[model samples]
Target: MGTITQFHLAFPVRDLDEARHFYGEVIGCPQGRSDTSYQDFDFFGHHLVAHISGEGRPLQSGRFDGEAVPIPHFGMNLDRASWEALATRLKAAMVAFHEEPHLRLKGKPGQHVTMFLFDPSGNALEFKSFDDPEQTFIP
Candidate 1:
């Protein structure tokens, strides 16, 4: 409704070069400021920083709408075109999907197209889109 604010998230990674390649090359995020220990990216307009923290932690899972989704995932709500294009790009890059691209909640108020995947560091990410953007927050 008003000016949407951008988000900033910093997470750990096993290696920096791996992260740079994945975020910059695979995900198509523009690289930002960085040093040896940390780097930043324009993650779908959000400020996402990957910090060097070896291996990080084991991922957990939770059931959502009959699907077992990664417990601690982060991602964006994109437009349909962008969501589909990214899905295609990830597939072409051979990124293993946590949840393959598909429609969810069909005919429901919250129907959406979504896909899930992990970065090289094993941090899970989800990207979704809705025909009606307001469906993103509907009850």
Candidate 2:
């Protein structure tokens, strides 16, 4: 594998203060640059900008491995230890889970653990871990 590059994503949010609290305090992302219209966060080594739009759309669900998962979500693929730690932190923060953390595709290739949740702005996020990291991109 070659060098991995960081990703940048800009999404709309209703309030900047709420975004800061959720991403900074609850999710544990370090705050970066910011202004009246937007705020940046170090989201799991990726660039995440929350722009003030004062509105957000409802999330739709999609089928995945016999489970309903929130569509148009964004998240990181972590190791099992980190994934579990984050899950515990989120639970302690009282954040509701869109899909509880659980294993999927048992005894099969690409089997992994996954969980889903939403931000204060209603943007869905997923965090998962693969049994075999090498199988991440395997079909």
24-136 per-residue lDDT for model 2 (tens digits): 99999988656666676877777566766645653354345666555556776677778888889999999999888899978977688888888999988877777876555
Show the lowest summed lDDT stretch of 10 residues, model 2.
Answer: 1-10
lDDT of model 1 at position 123: 79
**How good is model 2 by TM-score?**
0.58
Q: Global CA lDDT of candidate 1, please?
A: 0.71
lDDT tens readout by residue for model 1, 21-135: 9998999988865666666687776756676765666425544456766655677767777777888889999989988999987897757888888898987887877667654
Q: Enumerate residue pairs that collide in model 1.
A: none
Per TM-score, the best of the predicted structures is 1
Error of 1 at 24 (Å): 36
